[model samples]
Target: MSVHAIFLSMLCILLGLAKPSSSATDTFVFGGCSQIKYAPGSPYEYNVNSILSSLVNSASSTSYNNFKISLPGSTKADIVYGLYQCRGDLSNSDCRDCVAHAVSRLGVVCPGSSGGALQFDGCFIKYDNMTFFGVQDKGVVMKKCGPSIGFDSDGMTSRDSLLGYLTAGGQYFRVGGSGNVQGVAQCVQDLSMSQCQDCLAEATLQLKNQCGSAAWGDMFLGKCYARYSSRGDHSRDHDSHDDNDNDDEMQKTLAILIGLIAGVALVIVFLSCLAKLCDRKGFFHISSKEDPHSLKAEIQEDRYIEARERK
Candidate 1:
């Protein structure tokens, strides 16, 4: 293959091998598109793209941000409002990656919709023509309850205590463990503390009432979520641990592949540079019998003779 083609092929392979920040975090929890569709190439479509781009860009710096987009002279219907919020525990880089994934998935899941919402394990994103920011929405968007453990009193007590602790915290994100139960709760940053408390209260209540004696449960409200896992009592925890292990192994394998690809790419670059250098110096057709140093000397002597002849 030509040197340029080889280089391009190597580059494509490198890019294809590159992995995202965290597959577990990028796992799709839920997504929905609006029933209302915007005309393709319409002004509203432009605003939607702009707002989604803003959301992805802003995620690198902050865990939560809201954006409003409206061009001058555009009507209110053409405006777009959007926000993205990453899980509190994620690093800025991870948050950026998660939000980017969510944004890309939004286009696939909610193509041309005037409104959409997507929730991933690590981030949440939503956009619409109407205003929804800072508005309290306690409506349940998702609920999952693990297999029932037939009412272990101690496990139930631990789960209840953890949920209560999650609600008592004033921060937007809370995590706690009680005995064998691990719990986490978070509300959108725009909510006031009281609003967050109310949201979590509703979420935990749902978990308690709907998932009674369950080994694990999740309650996702419009603006908040609460989840708890009872260790050693559920398969979900074990499955998650196995998934993490697999992810680690896959990452290590990818790292080795990247290293190998990068090495090959460097070698190709070096050879290309050397070939260019040789071609520029007129060294492409040196006789096999000639020493390279002697060839260089002969070329210089020929150049000198040519200069003398010209004079």
Candidate 2:
């Protein structure tokens, strides 16, 4: 098969493996596409398209809670770096769905952009044209808090204990509850111990300073995220056989059905484009007068322009 055909086949397999789905609690948090734009026919654009499939595949195929992949561009000038991290409480299936949804959503939101990041309640995904691995980004990307319900001593204590446990432990993440208060703290796997500590400290400070006295709060930083809640039994029981869990499963089933339909549609589109290219260049006519190299170059230009137009 041709390179394009291989890419399409790989995409189909990855989409199937991802089994894109959503649950009652799974919701889009926030994300931003980079401002840097690539020209219609630039190598950077090609690299982005080529590597996106691999990134999504890597993210969904892993049983581990976190996944990261980096692919060099066709040339040395550009590369694609990507990573996905699921919350500590999520199941592997749920994690795959979140990551798949994130990959698709971020691609649409930032079409042809050089970089982007998307965060959901259960997972986070990010990609860029440069090497961002092992780097600690302390910047605050987002912060949100529930309505103030005044101060609760138990909540504050639990939150402190959560952070304290994370600081003392060697793990990159911690989740637990004390009394009626529940909290979670996590740092990306790429961070060093010291870097993770610094990020958690900054995140904790932001959670306190920005979300004062709120019943529930979440702070997303460059390399870490912290959350706490004091609003009625916030602890999650992943193994519970309850009505809410059933509803969540139903939602996931529907989401998976929709994703499969979308995947089929994408395959149709890709095949159509391939057919047109083949016909336009007389691919079956080896003795045709047209130069194969020129036709391929034209096809590349066409794809780039189409991508830009869609954006």
**Best-fitting candidate, scored by TM-score:** 1
Residues 11-111, candidate 2: write the lDDT tens digits. 57655755534473357778898898877777777666655565556555552333333344356656667777777767767777777777788878888
Residue pair clashes in candidate 2: none
After superposition, the stretches of candidate 1 with alpha carbons farther than 4 Å from their true spots are 1-22, 232-311
Best by lDDT: 1
TM-scores for every predicted model: 0.71, 0.63
In model 2, state the lDDT of residue 44: 72
Q: Give a tens-digit lDDT track for model 1, residues 124-143.
A: 99999999988999998998
* lDDT for each candidate structure: 0.87, 0.72
